[model samples]
Target: MTTTGTEIPGPAGLPLLGSMLDLKRDSLGTYLHAQREHGDVVRITAGPPGLRVEIYGVFSAEGAQQVLATESANFRKDNPFYEEVRQSFGNGLLTSQDTDYLRQRRLVQPLFTRRRVDGYAASITDETSAMLATWRNAPDATVDVAAETTRLTLRAVARILFGVDVESAVDVVQRSFPIIGEYTLTRGYSPANFPRSWPTPANRRATAAMDELYAECDRIIEKRRADGDAAMGEDLLTLLTHAESDEDTPLDASEVRDQVLVFLLAGHETTATSLAFALHLLARHPEEQTRAREEVVRVLADGRVPGAADLDALPYLTKVLKEAMRLYPAGPVVGRQAVAASEIDGHTIPAGATVVVAPWVTHRHPRYWDEPERFDPERFTPEREKARPRYAWFPFGGGPRACIGQHFSMLESVLALAMILQEYELEAVDVEVPVSTGITLRAAGPARCVLRPVGRGTGPA
Candidate 1:
């Protein structure tokens, strides 16, 4: 984020409060509306931080990209929001910066690389098949599509990454993840300043829950070590072990524990949420679902199962997934803190200013997209997609700080949906799915839908 001249008119950032109140209320919609009214490059003078902050939401994507990439030297990834997360997770990649981030990414990147993840694609297919078979989608048999999607992704990740069964840890992981992931609510209280050991019941429970989850991870790592199969396939744990050994800089057990914590928290949940939203969007727009089913039908030719080879053949499947992400983005926004003064589009941002670039805002900005609210996957066709700005649909973010798991996530979501489209129809029927945003957005209630078994063989050209 950069600074401006003396005449940059800003919205009414509440005195001693800043835009936090407005942000707290409706996060995405409210912020974008403010941007539309107060020009794109608006600053909120946060009284708490006592600094003039810049927002590049409805403005230019270039500004957001600059903050995330080129001009990133003046900013840090671990913002105020991350300070409270320290108790739950130590210095892991999600909140780490610079060298720590580079090291952790190097260690964790391989686990999700194309070649390695393909080795586990069969497990993904199997997991999706099993989940679909279990849900017969009767008229009254309400299913929380969000929860089920998370459960499936979690199970597949656990099995493929750490060689564990997510079923055994489902309740524990699910409950713990969302509670702690409520970053907007928890950002105000720092563990160092306002410790959860105090009387705040919700905070106390969340901290304890995170501790237990980490303890479980430690036990899993211990068992894996004891089993002494370091030569196992290029799974996450295996990659960590091998990478450290290869560099002759072995990560101690605690560090390995941290990686596991971050990887499980970051890698699995977000992808699951994206998949859930993908299904939800598909359910709402039957035409896309029909197209997906048709593609699946065409692909299952000659007993060839849906594998890595067929991953890219389903162009419509990829388009539908991308469109869903634009509507219901998983990582709604990215935040940063300035280490020094910066300037962008004539906006003056002081040092120590808190900055936010909301993808939810950019994805829906009317100036950048046509029918931004419509559920239209054709917007992503090879021809039309080129007409929009790059950041207009950055579900996985962009540039150097882009999600490292993009390949893994794209592969998992497509294959999971493909497998489902091949077997069952997940039809939404008068389901009231409320939005609950956290580390990811999930349905607050059951995504009630009628399920009908499609013949195991229908899809599109």
Candidate 2:
């Protein structure tokens, strides 16, 4: 904590081919155009014999809450981009380390606290009205609507994490969790990067689909602990079979099947890529999808859908799901490791470098946004999002290694945006096709729309 009166300045780079070839030609708009010619903090590398290390670009949200929470003992998601995603998300607790990720984040942080995610808001409004009754609209009706909002939040996180629906082996666990998001992240730092075997069809279909999805979660955790069903259905695999730690030891079956495959690959790809970028930004903003369909019929008029007392009466559908996670941010580049030799603003980051806390380049930081590539969802109301800069707006990342399904991906993205604004009306069908980052931020494909029906008394008459 000694970064005194400026003298840092290490921008203009070269090193073993630093500035990572303009960050591999346009990763989050070339690192926000080198943060407008290097300001916040910048230094790059990825050279060596392979995937080098060292990067800082903090972009102050209190310097990302002092490196993910008060310089948490000198920055650390604990190395090499969370050890290349804990080699296929095995160590789980989002790739563990220190004290085995602080004892599995305090035994799975009381099943996502906030009163157990407001008791799963009536199973996320009954799995978003059974996925808006298969979105019908007649005349050659269609609906990919981002693969049915990621199969209705992966069948409501497989009924709140294993009460049911291992859905006939979910396509061998969704074709093996995108082979850890198409590895090649900086061409893998040769711990023997394997690409030779059987023409790599995404690493031979994720080694033949995570070996039958870990033998069907090890026979449903050995028939839910041999019929004792571990104090029965409290979901989340019965709260990790009543968690324990502080030497009280528990969690074994291969560390609870790698923490249930990190809550089934981050509980259905970050709420199905934030409800498919909030239905492709409310089908290209038809006046903010008619003010989120008149606040979902002025707060579920009587057709009764969103409960948990209508999630505080839909604050404009929670600002259109926090401006569609501030324009699509499902784990957009987040890596860490510095456990020694630190120096942010003035740049050093020596000890085991490799850092990249990018929330897609600190949520479009034009020194706290203005027309930051507009899609202006009234800049997240609440007085224009308190004029920006709370870490500019991290998606689901912050302290104590954030994102333990951040409130079950924010009430499954506000119960699938109030069951698709309580039965459709999204007009404009082709505006939002921009985003590209793979392992989460989607829509380089099916964003197509057209789900009219808001007729009968035109909602909230």
Leading candidate by lDDT? 1
lDDT of 2 by residue, 310-400 (tens): 6667777777777777767887767676677666655655666555667776677766667666667677877767877567888888887
Q: Give the TM-score of each candidate.
A: 0.88, 0.35
**Predicted candidate 1 versus true structure: per-residue lDDT over 1-461, tens digit per residue:** 43454355566667666676666566666667767788666665433553434443325676677777778777676565666555567677667778777777776666666787777788788888788767764335445677788888887777665665355455567767767677324554232245556667676777777877777777766766776764456557656655552443566677787776666776677887778878877777788799888888898765345887788898888988888888777877777777886776567666776777777777777877777878888888887778766766777877776887788788889898887777667678644466655655656676655555675433310
Candidate 2 has a TM-score of: 0.35
For candidate 1, give the lDDT. 0.70
TM-score between candidate 1 and the true structure: 0.88
lDDT of 2: 0.68
